[model samples]
Target: MTYLVNNPADFVDESIDGFVAANSNLVRRVPGGVVRATRTPPGQVAVVIGGGSGHYPAFAGLVGQGLAHGAAMGNVFASPSAQQIYSVAKAAASDSGVLLSFGNYAGDVLNFGIAEERLKAEGIPCRCFAVTDDICSGPADKASERRGIAGDLTVFRAAALAAAEGKSLDEVYEFASHANDRTRSFGVAFSGCTLPGASQPLFTVPKGRMGVGMGIHGEQGIEEVDMPSASDLADMLVDRLLDERPDGAASPRVGVMLNGLGSVKYEELFVLYKRVSERLEAAGLTLVQPEVGELVTSFEMAGVSLTLFWLDDALEQAWTAPATTPAYCRGGVALEGEPRDDADLAAAHEEETPDASEDSKSDAAGMLAVIETIQAKIEAEAEDLGKLDAISGDGDHGIGMDTGARAALSAARRAVEKGCGAGTVLMRAGDAWANEAGGTSGALWGLGLRSVGACIGDENSVAAPVVAEGVVEATDAIMRLGGAEIGDKTMLDSMKPFSDKLAEEVKAGTPLRQAWRRAAEASQQAADATANLAPKKGRAKNHSDKSIGHADPGAISFAMIVSAVADTLESLHEDAA
Candidate 1:
């Protein structure tokens, strides 16, 4: 239970503020996250790493000399938005390219991949890689699908060290990839973690039982079993990792990290590490500079993970490299570089608002009202949505939606105040939603809104045909960007139906308000129908059986938004009459 919290919505932001204040000597706050205070070498590749916020010491704490140049921090247990990643990369980038790395989670993959493409399009070299080292997340043959856990340290270190050595972008990427392939981690939780302001933990373990193969983000474990003694638990962890040793590993030496998830004390870890060391030595493997403490953590989770980094010659050299950061440090660091100039660290600025026709400005005001209505709907249903998502996912969907909708409303209001057009208002709102929400749904919704905005330009009055066209554009953009089909049990399940119904009604000359109401009805039906589906993508895919009776949170939220918009339109018509 997290006791110290003001507004749960502002927790991540406030925490980052305090973190930057305390670590100002080693790091400085950037727009999206934190960057190293010292300047990198002129031609060195910038190793930018990140993920959700709760996993402290992992992201911001790792930014310094011989480690990550920057970290794009996100919402708690949510991946950073593409805009956030782009901002961090731009701030940290030098003459050389940037290397983006993070855990192998769906949200992180989507957001980071988008950022990577954006950087390349802007003529900045960038490459993104996800660490897949958790042995129990997927079958051995499907190693790429495994979730990254405590083993992230090994891969991040290898890449950052190579970058600090002035290696090229390709070299840094190769090192990170190779490290990921050679690393393996396994963990178990005695109890689950509670998110800030939440009344209950995400998941619970029965008395005398332990959840095995647990994720750091409060994801339920794959299996539950009787709690074992410390010695037996160490053997269990050591044996699992040893069995999955990477092929072609000729070295007997390995780097070991016995990581505490959150609440586990250092004394307990040392006890476990003693048995772990004995087990590894007895198995004829040598441990080099083994770390036994909190590294990658889940906010107050009572769990531990064991990570083994099988080291070849190159990997060992990189592993031994010196580093100094807020939470982690190696042997003596020189601190030889000059402090980064404040001008060089300026955040990316929002674009200037464009002029709008009077009619378009009137439409913008209506859009603002619609956005406000959506925000209200999301806030009202957030708890129920989160409960639904917790059936198979991490249970943050409701909070994420509420956060995004509020941000969108704020941005829409600002755009309207500036006398912007409907298109500009929607586009600005979308950007704000993505930047603040920072997750898969955030990225997709942002893309969809931006697409609609592109179809309805600032100069034109929005009509039924134009609105239907914008819906089609939005649907197409979501499908293209998310790579999820209609039946994938995502927001598309509702969005596609809504788009199709609205287009058909408009083609038959239906009034815009009536057609939109009909479309919202169709969306609701589609969202409900998703209860019969087994998710084929995202985090729910890992627990498809558990999701069978629950509609996807994304689909439900989309339906809610459209229905709310329909009601808003009707209210406006009534007021005018």
Candidate 2:
């Protein structure tokens, strides 16, 4: 458990602040995450890598001279929002282009993929790739479906080295992909990690036993076995990795990283490494600069991951290149770049309010009330939501939703105070939720609100039919962005039912308030029904069997929000009457 923390809600942000303070010479704080304090050369590809916080050296610590140019840090065990990724990429971008890379996780895929598209739409050359190195996550034939683990270091390093050599975005992406393809990681844990303010660990291993194939995000392993000696454990890790070596490999040399997942100290790691080295040498493999310490860690998880990065001639060259970051360093790096100017950073700007009719402005106030209701509901139900998610995921859903809803309410209030229309208010609120929440649910909710806002223009009064249309638009936007259908056991399972019912009622000339109430009921039913279905997406999909009896946290949260909105709408109607 984490001992030092002010507010659990503010842990990620405060941690980032302290990290930037300590590494001032190596990194500078950006809006979303951190960037190298020194500027990159003109026309050099900017290598941006990131994921959730708690993995210290992985993200911010690697931002310096010859590694990641920037990292879009997110909440603990959550993907960074699209807005955050876009901001970090823009800040680190050079004349050449930006190359985005991260672990092959659902939230990261959704958020980073959106950011990549946004960059290209703005005419900035950009490409994104996900590292799939955890051999335990998927079958070898479906290697791309594997989650990234400690092997992220090799992929990030290779990309950064290519970028430092002034390669184009395409070349940088190629190098990262090659590194990912050649890398394999396998992990085990003696115990699970606890989030800040949590009373217990996310999961637990039995006494005198260890979990095999455990995930870094506090997920229980696929199997459990009696604890083995250090030498026996080393053989288990090294042999499993050796069996899954990349196909068509041309070299006997490999870059090894025996990464400690938080609580395991260097001494323990070195002991394990001794046996690991012997096993590799026995298998006729040569080790190159084996790293045996904390690299990519989960918050105080008593675990370790072994990564074998198969090195070809090209990869070996990049692997041996010089680097200087806060936590990890290679050979010697010449410091030639000047410090970046604060003013040159991409800072947030105040948005100008657009003209709107009195009716639209009044409706914007109503929208603010609904958002307030959502914020309250999410806060009240956060613990329950997290419990549901913990059954199959990292168990941060409740915290993420609470953070997002609060941000949305704050943004909606500000927009209404500025005399913005209902459309602009919802859009701003959506942006805030997406930016602050920084996960799969956050991105989808943000997109849904923005879509609804866009469908209901500021120039027109919002009627029952128009509201129904907006909801449909929102549902469509989520489906498009998330690529999930109604039965996928996501929020879409509830959202689709609510949207369709609302549209049906509106088409039948039902009152807006009455239609919304009915739709909210439908949403609740759908959410409850998800308990009978297995998850088809997100982290939960990995442990689908475990989630069979529990409703999806995303679906439950959606139901709660819509029901709260219905209550808020009824109250407003009663007051007006």
TM-score to native of every candidate shown: 0.92, 0.93
On residues 227-281, what C-alpha lDDT tens digit does candidate 2 reach at each position? 9999999999998999998987879999999999999999999999999999999
C-alpha local distance difference test of each model: 0.89, 0.88
TM-score of 2: 0.93
Cα RMSD (Å) per model? 2.9, 2.6
List model 1 lDDT by residue over 1-577, tens digit each. 8999999888988999999999999998888898899876789899999999999898999998878999999988889988889999998888898999999887888788878978998898999999999998999999988999889999999998888778899999998999999999999999998888889898899999999999988888899999999999999999999999999888999999999989999999999999999999998998988999999999999999999999998899878888899998997687757788788788667568898887787778777888888899899999999999888887778888888888999999999898899889888888888888888989887777877776876887777787789989889877876768988899999999999999999999888899999999999999999999999888888799999988999999999899988877643322221
Evaluate residue 350 in candidate 1 and report its C-alpha lDDT on the 0 to 100 scale. 58
lDDT of candidate model 1 versus the reference: 0.89
Consecutive 10-residue window with the lowest summed lDDT within model 1: 568-577
Runs off by more than 4 Å, candidate 1: 463-469, 500-518, 567-577
What is the Cα-based lDDT of residue 409 in candidate 2? 92
